[model samples]
Target: MVLYTLAPGIRLSFNEIYTSSWEKGDSSIFGERMLIVNFCIHGRCDVSLAKNRYAIVKENQVCISTVMPTKDFYYPRSLYEGIQLYLDLDILHDENGQDFLSALGISLEQIVEIFCEKDGLYLHQMNDTLRTLVKDAWDGKDDIEIGTLRYLAVRLLHEIMSMPAESETETYFTRSQIAMVKEAETLILSDLTTRITAKELADRFGVSESSFKFYVKGILGDSYLNYFRKKRMEKAAELLETTNLKVIEIASAVGYENQGKFAKVFADTYGVSPLEFRRLSK
Candidate 1:
């Protein structure tokens, strides 16, 4: 993957590969505060963010609005590749921000609330103009790339924030509920290597252990430990495929103390020994 900072508060990143499938890899935790918008330009890949997993992103499709400290993977990968744009919300405090939001018919108050709530993993229906802008970003247009991406980003955000609350009434997870989950997810990811117990997580959210587990299971369909392991394993897999790091080294990096246990878990999840997986991947 190659990352380019297109402007002061915006960036473009992408990777192109020709392969039957992507070897299982580790999830990436975003440390900086920014909103990420990803466009799958060429092929398909599964992206797991927060507690939710996106299985297939095809050409011209987009995944928008994820906060930092999230996990993701690309799956059943066939020459899978795409571009990601990161935008700093602070930029919206200025005239450009106002103009952009105004054009999308979103109010300043709504934007503030959305940011305060820290929403995650929002997918928007794409229109022709939005689709074309994403293509332009991937094509590396020098003259208008940054402006186009920023414009599209704001437009998409407005569309999401402006939708009638009633329209989402049937959704199992409300906007507030989604925001809370994302907040919990962010806390969990902030320190992936640390030992975080259920009690601690519940305390942080001011909820009972049962409630926390229920929320996690209800939205993510898994317990907290299972979700964390998936994220760690996903990150470990990415390192194995992209680097020449030793197995022991990779194990330690992903928070494993016993190499034997790490290898066992990795093999079970991936259906191959770590060494074998690495060799075949290359």
Candidate 2:
């Protein structure tokens, strides 16, 4: 993570090739009163929000939030890249920060009025223009010219502030629900040789079938079978690349007793047969 001070009390951060192992969220170190915008460009992130609820920030999604003191936030995918814009009102309302914001036709009070409420959070899907600006932010991470960066930050901020309110807030699931989904994933994927149905997995975990599917899709961004199949194939690919195991043995290791089906799925995912992939690897 690289931090650039665009303006007093206004900073932008670029995260490149990062992975998180913690599940805690506390922003007190930054300041007491601040607005945060998170641009998830490549991977998904779990955002712990107020009232034991949480939000998921997937690729190409933006989270504009003022509610802090969230807990248990983590990155699902290992490699994550994104940009964070921080506006600490404590300093932004100061003489210099105030003067800077005023010069850009921005009133600090208005932003607070619109985005700050009890547990305020707004999630938006980034379109082409917004995505472009975020890309510019990424491209300018090493830029010595701070003026271009300042413009990019303010422009992205303005774009987010101008978007309409959405009802996706209701889609947020509870922390326990996320926990249940994760535990299910761990249990089912713990042993590649053990086969389990979606219904069985959900019932084993004490969640209803519908709620189970909802949480799986919400957290993993895919249905249970798709997510499991992809995970299996990932393990298969790693084994193929690293081990002396034959293709059939690798299939059983990833829970595929039928070599034909395993070959088909592997081919569909990687655009090559397992043997071809191994031969190409050599």
Best by lDDT: 2
lDDT of each: 0.59, 0.77
Per-residue lDDT of 1-282 in model 1, one digit per residue for the tens?
666654455556666756533443323324344566666777655444445433245566555554443333433323566766656655544556445445556454454345334345444345576566566665764454556656655665554454332212112444444455557766656665666777787887787888777766555545877877877787788889999999998888878888899999898889998889899999
Displacement of the residue 15 alpha carbon in candidate 1, Å: 19
Q: Model 2, range 1-282, lDDT digits (tens) per residue?
A: 667787677887786655543444245336777777889889877877666657678888888777764665566545578998787877777765355556887765676666555456767778788999888778766764678777777688677666665524547777788888878877877898888887897788787888899888888788888988988998899999999899999999999899999999999999999999988888
Q: Give per-model TM-scores.
A: 0.40, 0.88
Clashing pairs in 1: 25-234, 25-237, 25-238, 26-234, 26-235, 26-236, 26-238, 27-234, 27-235
Query: Candidate 2, which ten residues in sequence have the lowest lDDT sum?
Result: 20-29
Best by TM-score: 2
Clashes of each: 9, 1
Residue 180, candidate 1: Cα error in Å is: 2.5
Clashes of 1: 9
